[model samples]
Target: MSEKVISDYNGYDYKKEFWENVDREYEDQADRMAIRRLLPKRMEKFADIGGGYGRLANEYLKRARKVYIFDYSKTELAQAKEIYGDKIETKAGDIYKLPFKDNELDGLMMIRVTHHLKDMPKAIAELYRVLKPGGVAVIEVANKRTLPKMVRYVTFRSKVNPFSKEVANYKEISADGFYNYHPKYVEEIFNKTGFKRERVLSVSNFRSKTLKKVFKTNNLVKMEEAAQTALAPIRFAPSIYYKLRKPEK
Candidate 1:
């Protein structure tokens, strides 16, 4: 078989370069709020797939008996190990070929990682295989059908179709394989992989630079919390979070 495309962050300091800033505090809090609502109250084995430097590990650490940060970067994993030490386990592996055995995880989450995946179906199947029956998985996607993009399409300002249920790639925006996917397409893949849709939350609804400049981060986060569930049906947000479960036989 041919080798699968992987978005390797081996030498990158994702936590420092991407997250350590005042500008994205609202987005970070918005994500955490959604995750808190979706994640199981308690679990035996929980993992954060593509959890670089364990940025969100503390969210699940108290809830799960065993928490792991699994990623494709040794550098990130090493950082995770340094920060978390024995509190959380770190593993380096591909999303399509996870190291965990079948039915080993009580719950798992893959946030901000879907866009990097070239074979989403294969990666999702691996998640289904590892999660126990009735286990929950929280997956996040960069949405192609955002309101701004739709407006651009309708106004003849952009060539891409926002209504189409296909993956949208703009290499010019980010050459590192950044993709935006339609929500329906992602849901269909999850359903095909035997996952039942539990809930959907529209995160980062107010991710405008102008809005951030005008309002405080906490106020924006409060607005985001209120809008996540209400705006989910329309799915006009740039980031969409899905709560899925594997049914018990």
Candidate 2:
């Protein structure tokens, strides 16, 4: 939240072209769907931290009075500017030291950014500071402990793992940069940052290319109904969605 904390985390140049490609490629279909679920009916001003390419920000603009899209990468901002025009504001800024005043934003959505953050607590505190009382924050993070993710780690040795030598050497960097998170870790971080946890949802409880193909058959609504009923009670869904709020009074 202070200048030093902000400065320390500012070294990652996400605005570069190469990183933008990484981010766009690593973008998750499930996260896009989850953000749609948590979106507010109407927001005065919404800020999206680490919103690469502004996909979610573009969607929020339709319902928000004003939208601000912040990312450390200028390359991503270029695409966002093309897609949004003047409807959305793009700023190359660090998430830890948001360039906004206290209680200045109505809502915040941080999609797939927790792992890239150098200090989760400081970043969340900044988000809490900028958000007005009753403002909501929705965060999307990969489940480090999920069965699918663990299998992927061992079998793929891909960008999803922060400890892999392949990823550590930057052979392949995930679109969002360094990401390492556990499913329940978010609750602890949010509570430490003064946000009260509200709702939690899971996505892609059972995800696989072959399984997805099966669900894509006859009726989309029926598939959704069946999946929700079957997976809603399960604790370890593939991806986790957290809805939190800044305390009022």
Candidate 3:
């Protein structure tokens, strides 16, 4: 049986929303670059877990012989199929109980999706289950320890504990959302799941209303690249990218 978990995505019609907005383009690009950089060099096949609308999976075509869009969202999965045609394959299942056979994937990525998961360990174990011994996986974390949040806490204007190992609850303009994790917590889970951490990058560093208004998207992307290259050791961005590998048997 699939493990029971809490999530904010059960009935969300993502195709009718989110990506449709012109304003959210830069945010999309921010995550796109993170996944692109950490993608495996040689991939025979890979599954883009929780890949809605196939936005991130589309980018994997350059590396993978086949890219699979695996998600439980009917609307978004249909949209992905219509948009990409036969270029990508679609699979329907819960991430807790992946549909693929054991050792089926050479690479995998779960981007912009982990925040909604309430059971991170079980999900990570499932990811490890289907991946070949030598396969690579890239996952994203919605870092609660962002620089802005910490600065706000120091200035006495915020209630969020950026350093808390516990999941942080948040509210949004549309709905009350799920929780975000500290990067260290996610790192510990990956380590416990038998994955070797390959790399970590602090991306979406320029994710602020003021900064976005003052700069163009192209310029923001350039600066994001520079931050990722120079500040490789620190993870103070709102989004943290992790590259992991299953140990070679």
Candidate 4:
């Protein structure tokens, strides 16, 4: 890792406000569970790219012999080191510049991190570069084409165009700003990156406060599990999780 600042990550503190919101935690857990199911049943090594504090990659211990938690935050990596000392390897590296050599990993994950990336194709290619042929990658993307976004657009004439918006190119979340990608755009990214798409899981469908309050947490999780695949083709959820495999070329 070259210690270069990527995606306005120079001075952002994720440890503080990250765990503060209730819905955020629920949504995170939901994303983690959805990503977990897509992982290979067995693997020798895997890297969790941009996985802060090792919360998401920790779940990979059961499936992979060696688990690597890669992040851009040194403080968060230190905290992850403290939490998983000998169990996992923690690397503070930029997502644009992964520390590992080419085709060294049997599996990799990038959950809840793609939104921060300004160049989606480049980042996806980098991830594909590190993965071995026939390896699997579970990537979570914030969906621009979702039910709530479309409903609001039609009902209230909101500024958000969920149906056909490309990259927003703003500076809201980061200096380069974050992006909410349509599933079509994401599939295009995969197509250009030499990755074969397996399927898409529509995650975080019940992430709103009203839905959380109306249903128990367990029930919401159950509902999410049941509805994810059925809703994915239509892109009905706020988050879309893609399971992709590198072709054996």
Candidate 5:
């Protein structure tokens, strides 16, 4: 049976009707970049840990022969089933104790999942376990080193006065709010876990919510391209992304 852990999103439904109906193209550019780093090889068997609502799985299904999703959120799994049909097979499971056999998957995609983990080592070990010899995996983090993120965290933890500091910009405790991560820490963990590091990709470059708002127009492709370049230099910096492969046994 799947473990009953606390909802990482603090009850926010990532698959709720409003979230699915809202114009996500404006905000999903970062997501697309994260997914692309995984680069699902055609006709391979893939597993998506923390595959919330199958958003990233939707992209994987287009390339892979078989795709399995493991998610703790039943609400997201329900939405995934409704939207993806049989293209995705979902298991209501936690990342800590994956249900699959060892060395079975060809690739793994952990999109937007790492920051929410209660235990990062256990989760990465499970990921390494299911992936077969020579299998690749993509991991994404919130990049705590980013200037924008630093300011936000500092302000949130400020003690002197609430009026003087900026108000907490992020209102909801989505999946990442519970357990936070930095890229260097992730790299060290992965290395200690025996997964060989490959490449890194950065998503949002600037910390300006104002700039994001200004660019959140109908022209999503243009906006993403601009953001991609802006964020390219720090793609390997903290709050970045990376590809890893399980060493061949």
Candidate 6:
């Protein structure tokens, strides 16, 4: 069998190059908002899977008694340690083979990490194995069937079919290992894994350069917050966030 294709960020300063330099405050805020809504208020143990440099640590730290930032990159974990200083524990490991034992975590989250995973089924099974019965997991996926992409496909501007369930690789246009998934395809995987879907949020609804140029960030965030739940059923956004729970029993 071939080895799994994982996105490595060892030497990369994702916090600086990806978040700070890119001016993606709107996307960042939107992500935080979605996480806050989904994450449980109180938990004994919670983890942020693939949480590089603990970017979303503040959101879960106050809620969970013990919070961990798990990633594959030691450099990113080191940076997280520097910023958090033991407030959050940092662990280095692969997603398919989590370090924790079965039913260990009370809650967990994976944001912007699923896109980098080539094997969704295997990765999600690991999430299921780690979470305790009735545990909550907030997962985010890069959506392929977004409104803009669908429009492009319908107008014959793009060859890729937005309605297909296959994973859409963006290596040609963007970074290697970057991928997008049809919402239904991901949902099917979650269902097969026995995770009960509780809530879905269509985040980053207005992620457009033109929209950012026209409106203030705060204004755009307000609109985004309103549209998240409203447009979730359609999964009309580029990023889809799901709140899932393992069955109690």
Best by TM-score: 6
Ranking by TM-score: 6, 1, 3, 4, 5, 2
Tell me the TM-score of model 4: 0.90
Worst 10 residues of 2 by lDDT: 162-171
Cα RMSDs, all models: 1.5, 6.0, 2.4, 3.0, 5.6, 1.2
Q: lDDT of model 1 at residue 127?
A: 97
Better of 5 and 6 by TM-score: 6
Maximum-lDDT candidate: 6
TM-score attained by model 2: 0.73
Tens digits of lDDT, candidate 5, 7-123: 453245776544466655544666675566457557478887888787766567877888888788877777788888888888887778898899989887887665565567777
Query: TM-scores for all candidates?
Result: 0.96, 0.73, 0.91, 0.90, 0.78, 0.97
What local lDDT does model 5 show for residue 164? 28
Candidate 4 ranges with C-alpha deviation above 4 Å: 1-16, 20-25, 169-176
- After TM-score superposition, the amount by which residue 246's alpha carbon in candidate 5 deviates from its true location, in angstroms, is 0.9
- Model 4: per-residue Cα lDDT over 1-249, one tens digit each: 222336544354565567653346667678777876798889999988987877775578888999998988887778778888888898877788799999999999998787777778878989999999999999998887777778988898667788785864436556656678888888998998899999788898887888877888888888887788778778878788899999998
Q: Write the per-residue lDDT of candidate 6 for residues 5-28, one digit (tens) a residue.
A: 768899999999999999899999
Q: State how far residue 210 of model 5 sits from its true place (Å).
A: 1.1
Kindly list the per-residue Cα lDDT of model 1 for residues 15-45, writing each as its tens digit: 8888984468898899899899999999999
What is the C-alpha lDDT profile of model 2 across 46-144, one tens digit per residue? 988887677666557777898888987776777778878998888788886788899999898987666566466677789999999999988775555
> In candidate 6, which residue pairs clash?
none
Alpha-carbon lDDT of model 5 = 0.67
lDDT of each: 0.91, 0.66, 0.83, 0.81, 0.67, 0.93
Q: Compared to the true structure, candidate 6 yields what TM-score? A: 0.97
Could you tell me the lDDT of residue 243 within candidate 4?
Answer: 93
